[model samples]
Target: MKVISDLEIAQTLHLPNECEELQLLMMKYECAMTEMITKLEVLSSEMSLKFQRNPFESIRCRLKSPQSIYDKLCSHGYEVSYQSIRDNLNDIAGVRVVCSFIDDIYLLASTLKMQDDLLVIQEKDYIIQPKNNGYRSLHLIVMVPIFLMKEKEYMKVEVQFRTIAMDFWASLDHQLKYKRADIADADAISEEMKISAELVSQLDNHMLQIRERIDAGEK
Candidate 1:
């Protein structure tokens, strides 16, 4: 039995009879995501072999849903077409890399950026300068060439590097903000999450320092 994907279900609901082309487009996005994930996995594996440890703890990837793509285009006052998706949306494919230490995030990011095939189009170092709400993560917009059966196409993917503590705090904070969006104490919740984000960053930095000290034979 062929597995029906969520994107297929979404395309059926939104695009109707006009989805034949979009299906192929979605496949390309999926393939691009797969290629990025493989690159990340290989990097992690090579790091483990060389350093006796993996730089990242986990890897996750996702393709944008058809509905999400449509909505985002509409919300941005852009035409909802394949051309628009190619031109405007840089995050059709996303990859999140979670690391054990804050330094690991930077280390992996620098290594990934140095790859010949991957182009770091944009970089956001949120670890050094977090958001007002305390969200901290390194975001990179990377472009890579995806070779198809007939031709090769350059695709953009959004890659995020986060330490385990940063991921933990961000996941919980996102859940609370999403689930409790209309709660009466929303301001208070936002303030509390901001504080929590600061504490998480501090802890991440502290752990990195401890690891550095250990590496330096300081015990």
Candidate 2:
């Protein structure tokens, strides 16, 4: 894999002389993360062109390590370790594809999976099975290769597929849930969110139907 230059790693860590060793170690992780994100972006663009769909609205990738790794190293005990960060990254390597209609999400996801370069490690069809919190989207863990001057290494990245309507509702839910402590009962809020989600789903289906009908007439 591409070995990151020591200077670049140093600049990113910004650690003092006392923490020079840790800085070097952190650089390897950072380089791996940077490479993963770059590959994801390229894949996203290619998928967009192949499927005649808009590119991802937003794409991000991250790396993490467990707290035990740090503890075993006998280094300073950081509240957040690389492993924890990596876990969170896996949870959110979110690639939101905001389309004009909801069916576009499924189309885009299916098209992406067909690419040979991308290896699907796991998939959670949240669109088909949304979370109890009304979270809706397709979560896929994909492994992509990053070619360096010396070698090539594969990195895992999480990709989340969602539509504009779903994004809007999720954003609002997050803001409202965090803004107030004792706002409403969790179940009550969840039920309301579910109702909204169903409405959005119906709207997506209706729009797709309209498009199909128009295409039929043109033909």
Candidate 3:
């Protein structure tokens, strides 16, 4: 992958065309995101070949939008420069893994942390300690080495592991946050969503228990 240096971008582009200039830098993040996605897909393939099972149900990758990155840097009071983004933001590239059961989330997270190539820089086990909003997921910030044309660069990519039920609740919760004008009672709906998150969590544990029993019987 060709790396566009800040000097090259600045010299070729005008000052007003900041977004276009930033978009050129996205190639680094794109490469970094693809590297993480490939690792996840390879893990899924190997698991299916060996155990006829996958630790995750699905894998999703995303790169932060140029506008979003600029906004985030301003929000954090950081310098709005390419080097500032690389130095401060750890979630420029993200990979989300949705699992079938709660245990599968852990199984996949532990497996990922064990990889020698990827270094687990930070971990947040929301399953063990649910957030105030009752959100549950295993979040890991991993540092992956992206081998560029001339030099290798270490980039941080956030990996989120969640169960199907957790994802279902989170998706609806996010949509509601955006469609607030359509709701009759915003506070009431927020409360109900929190309750729904709790219910889905309980459901996840029950399903995990049943899965464990089935596996035990098979063994």
Q: Best lDDT goes to which candidate?
A: 1
* Residue runs of model 1 more than 4 Å from their true location after superposition: 1-18
> 1 or 3, which is superior by lDDT?
1
lDDT of 1: 0.83
**Tens-digit lDDT string for candidate 2 (1-219):** 333344543354332342444443444455545655565467667777875555456644443332333343344343333344334334322334456666666766676688777788889987778787767877777766666578775555666667677778878888877655476586677688789888877776787799779858877
Name the TM-score of candidate 1. Answer: 0.90
What is the lDDT, from 0 to 100, of the residue 183 in candidate 3? Answer: 74
- Candidate 3 lDDT tens digits, 40-152: 88878887787667778888888775557767888899887766877898888888999898877776778878988889999999888988777888899998889868988
* Model 2: ten consecutive residues of lowest lDDT: 64-73
lDDT of 1 at 174: 77
What would the per-residue lDDT of candidate 1 be over residues 1-219, giving only the tens digit for each residue?
123354564453354544666667667777777888889898888989987788988998888766678778888998877677788998988999999998778778888889998898999999899988899999999987799989988788899999999999989987788877988998998998999898898898899898888878843
Q: Quote the positional error of residue 20 for candidate 3 in Å.
A: 8.9
TM-score of every candidate relative to the true structure: 0.90, 0.65, 0.85
